[model samples]
Target: MIDTADEFESACRILAAASGPVAVDVERASGFRYSARAYLVQVSRRDAGVFLFDPPAIGDMQALQRAIGDEEWVFHAASQDLPSLRELDLVPPRIFDTELSARLLGWPKVGLGAVVERTLGIVLKKEHSAADWSTRPMPQSWLEYAALDVEHLLDVRDLIADELAETGKLEWALEEFADELVRLPKPAPAEPWRKLNGLNKIRGRRNLAIARAFWLSRDALARELDAAPGRLVPDRSLVAAVVAQPRSKGELSSLKEFTGRQSRTQIDRWWQAFVDGRATEDLPAERVPSDALPPVRAWSGRRPEADERIKAAKPAVEAHAEFLSIPTENLLTPDHLRRVAWQPPEPLTEDAIGEALASHGARPWQIAQTAPIIRSAFVHAAQASDDTDESAS
Candidate 1:
């Protein structure tokens, strides 16, 4: 591991002189840690070999960033690693996401191992993928596993690039990568605790408040200790406690359903949170208003015309994606299709549909191909609705 300042700088210097795009991957303790931090960062470059760095042991990453910052970085699933990499100021100027490339190419399997096996004919041992990455002095086998992540990534990127170029979709991949590079972080939901497991089993605003309180208390404790909330107290246990409505710490501990590594030890804390939730008047509503669209199944009865629009347009867009030899979601997101179907703009010309598609985060290549299909399908949907109404009358 490149822990000392001199060893780190030496690795950076080697990477600086290495030719071609830098292949990079980050190992994070996703389920085991509260914070999504880069426990270990792996980078491989041609001629320079691969370097493994202990992110926590390193003081700053600016030196390493300068070494290869301007070069295009390659990753199998870039988005999953980019956030943690950014936390260390190791930003990339451009990226080549092999997973996204495979998706655009309409490959059946896009996982790193699958892509590697399919593209390079090498199978990667993935037993250590879910291992705790934050362990100090990581096991030798684990280090090798981390190193393997980026070992053949650049080769996969090259092979995929050639195939994409041959298919006339290289530009599409670049545009997709650019958009992903600048994608903004999603805003945190207002009522995150509302998504608790078995939440529907608990009814009434008071009970909901208790659930929310328990979730919030658990979240605070988890964050403070840097432990995954689920590790400390599983969602099922938290929800069960609310349903049981334990009045005291002893009662809470006595319930078998209310159990976890920390549940019994932190009984007083949980009890207090429950008491506060019971006394507080700030109860959550049963249903919240949102801009989210109704399910497509419900649209058939609630909005017949809109239902026809999605039914006709969705399959049409999907068929076009097939014609282009690309995945439907890769061509355009389903949410965007649903949004346009639910509420199309005035003067729904091809240009208007294209604009709508762009507004919903569709790339130019996607809008160019799908806008006409959507406009024509919408026109047919309206005409079909009119015909049905006339026959009924």
Candidate 2:
């Protein structure tokens, strides 16, 4: 385990002198910690071999980044690790995501272990996936598991790249990889309390407000303790306490989930949260945001023409995706499809539809393939509307 500045410097020299793209992987203590910091970073190169460095210990990766200058960094699921990597001032200039490539090539299973076994006849162990990587004096066994993650990643990348090239989808994969580089982790959701599981079961705005209070309280406590929000106060227990609306700290502590030592200790805090919730003015309503689209399920009554447009447009997308043997989602996001279909361009022609898709961030390849199909669907729908009107007249 390289921890000191000297060791990291040595590792950098080894990496800088190595040939070919570097393979990278990171282990994060997701369920065990509040922050998404990388506990361990593992890197491999064909000549430099595998090196596991403790990011928290060395506290400097600038030297490491310099070592890896313009070489492509290969990762299994690049998005999952990229954000944590960015925290250490490490960002890949060029990246090749094997998982994204597999999805583009229409692989049925894209998990690292599954893809490795299918492509290279090797099985990866999976026991330590849930282990707390933030523990001090990292165990040797866990270190070995982390090392194995990047050991064969370069080989796997080579094989997958060849297959992508054979099918003339290499450029497509590159485009997706480039897009992934700019893809930041999704923003913290708005009204995060509304996302609590089984919150819908709580009746009335008052009780909903109570649930929100509990959620905010729990989130603050979790952040203070550097613990996962769920670990601090399970969602189910929070919802139960709010729904029951226990009048006092003692009454709230009587619940089974709250009887645990951890929960019992925080009874006053929980009770205060409930009281504050009821006393607060201007509670949030469950209405959609002004700029947001309504749920697709309600579109039939809310916007019947949009519903008709989407229904007409979907088959075209599915047919094209099937012909190309890629996931329909990779071809074009369903949300983007819905957006274009709902408000199709004026004088709907192939060029106009293409412009709409491009505006919504569709790649050129995607627009080139999907625009013609969507235009045909729109034109056909318009003709059907004209025929219906003529018959009524």
Candidate 3:
């Protein structure tokens, strides 16, 4: 609730004086707002207390940055919060992601509420987890809930750290956490409109263009009003409008399926999108180019050699993972293994396989474990093929 400049300064000073890594959490109005902007940011330190910050009220967060910028920050799922946190200039020097830590340590439940209750025996009411944080005159109950998020975080972190050390996964967890800190934001998809639900259900290039127009128009309006696009017009309504082929704004407004709070009220806008979509020279293509490989299950009929390599290697790799007491996917991502098997680099030694895995963003620890297994699998598959051919001849 520290909104004023004076209160912010006081809060920063208090945080600066506090000891240990800062526990941080962000509350974003994901479904209710247009942007993933942080409605509230909560920070906790050892000696100091929990502080709830209103980002819209406090425009400049560099002061908070200066206060705790040098200290390591702790978050449950740091990746999910980093984008919103960066928007406020609240980047951390280092971060310990409890979620990643739990994953590495093979903990069954990694959610903040579960982690706290499991480790510290505190049952937090999670009713407000999905509440619209953009609401004004913050409820007292919400404030208490927000405070509790960071309340036992540091304690839980300490407990988890000990468990990680006991299981010989502390270094692995640290490596994962460090990687999580520097994870680049995924690039925005080229034709984000193509992601709309039931988009494929509508066919023809003209219809595709109409859908594109609808998405763009809706996006612009949503950005302007700072409201979630779905709130103005849901995806189903847009698809319906395109399918109906409304003759005029009147027809568009009258379409029963084209229903939203602003659907009829903004009839002119919706109608224009349809008109432009029909007349424009830029019709959307049916399919976009992709570099993604076929699913692993399809490798058998597509590439028998790759199928052989994966079949020989995957079970062995999985067995090792079980021996190590880690998830198979965590040890080496299934896709990374499949890609390497499909098109393995020539001179496929352990080192060569390791390099190929590295090119696909595998961590050093993962490459170290799986490269030998992969090399052996490929060689074994090749030798088995030679033996079968010899027997036939």
Candidate 4:
């Protein structure tokens, strides 16, 4: 492991002299740690063999960045690793995502191990994939597993790229990878506590407020202790506490879910959470305001005409996707379909529908195939509306 700045510079010198695209992978402590920082980063090249760096110990990587500035980085899932890599100022100018390429080629199983096994006839062992990388004195077997991740990435990329070229989908794959590079991280949810697994089972706004308060306290404690929020207190216990609404420390201590050693030690802390929750002035809203269109399945009861429009538009999209041999979602997203059907653009001509699709992030190919179908559906709905008005008169 290249831990110190001096060791990192030596590794950078070696990598800078190598001649080929870089294969990159990272190991993170997802459930075991509070942060999403990369614990270990592995990079391999045709000439460089393989190199591993401990990111936490090597504080600055400007030299390493300079070495890889102009090379194309290959990753099994580029988007998943890019964010953590970016945290260390390691951004690639060009990238190829094998996972995205496999999806474009319509491969059913696109996992790293699956793709390598099928394409290169190499079956990778995945035993330590979920092990805690935050532990010191890293095991030799785990390090070997990490190294193997990037060993055949270059060969995998070549074989997949060749297949994409033969099938005339190379441009499509490039477009998808470019989009992933520029894609922004999703914003944190407004009420993260409400997303707990069993929160929906809790009744009443009052109980929800109590559960939310408990979740917030647990989250703060987790951060302080550098542990996962779920590890500090499970969602099931939060929901149970809300249901029981225990008024005293004694009552809260008697709950089965709170019988763990940690929970027992933190009995007063848990009791205070309940106390503050019951006394909070602003209880959480039962339902947050939403700007999104309602579910398509609910359109029948909410608006029959909108339902008619969606039913008319779907078959055309399905036919086009089948003809082109692509997934229905890749052809046109359901959210885009629903938005257009709910409130179509004015004039509802082929041109207007085309612009609408573009604003909704549809590619040129998708817009060309889906615009006409959506226009026809809206036009038919308009004619039906006109006839209904005339008959009422």
Model 4 pairs whose backbones collide: none
Compare candidates 3 and 4 on lDDT and give the better one: 3
- Candidate 2 lDDT, 1-393, residue by residue in tens: 899999899999999999999999999999889899999999999989999999999997899999996799999999999999999999999899999999999999999999999899999997899889999898999999999999999999999999999999999999889888996666777888888888888877777788889889888988898888888778888878877778788889888755332577888888889998888885768553655677888888998778778888898899899999999999998878898878889988889988889887788888888999998887787777778889999
Each prediction's whole-model lDDT (CA): 0.92, 0.88, 0.90, 0.85
User: Clashing pairs in model 1?
Assistant: none
Best-to-worst order by lDDT is: 1, 3, 2, 4
Distance from true position, residue 85, model 3, in Å? 1.3
The 10-residue segment with the lowest total lDDT in model 4: 257-266
My TM-score estimates for the predictions, one after another, are 0.97, 0.95, 0.95, 0.91
lDDT of 1: 0.92
What local lDDT score does residue 175 receive in model 2, on the 0 to 100 scale? Answer: 85
List clash counts for every candidate, in order.
0, 0, 0, 0
Q: What is the lDDT of candidate 4?
A: 0.85
How does residue 38 of candidate 2 score in lDDT? 95
lDDT of 4 by residue, 1-393 (tens): 778888899899999999889999999988877788899999998888888889888888788889987999999999989999999999999899998888777787889999999899999998988988877778989899999999999999999999999988788778777777887897899998988879888877778878888888888888887777777677888788888878789988888876443577787788888988888888878889878898889998998888878888888778877776667887788788888888788887888888888787776766877898788867787688779889999
Better of 2 and 4 by lDDT: 2
Give the alpha carbon lDDT tens digit for every residue of 225-283 in model 3: 89999999999999999999988888899989998878988888999999999999998
Candidate 2 residue-wise lDDT at 224: 91
Model 1, 1-393: lDDT tens digits are 788899999999999998899999999998999999999999999999999998899879899899998899999889999999999998999999999999999998999999999999999999899999999879999999999999999999999999999999999999999999999888888999988888989999999888899999999999999999999989999889988988677889899988788988998888988998899999999888888888899998999889999999999999999999889989999999999999897899999988998998999999988999999999999998898899999
RMSD of each: 1.2, 1.8, 1.6, 2.6
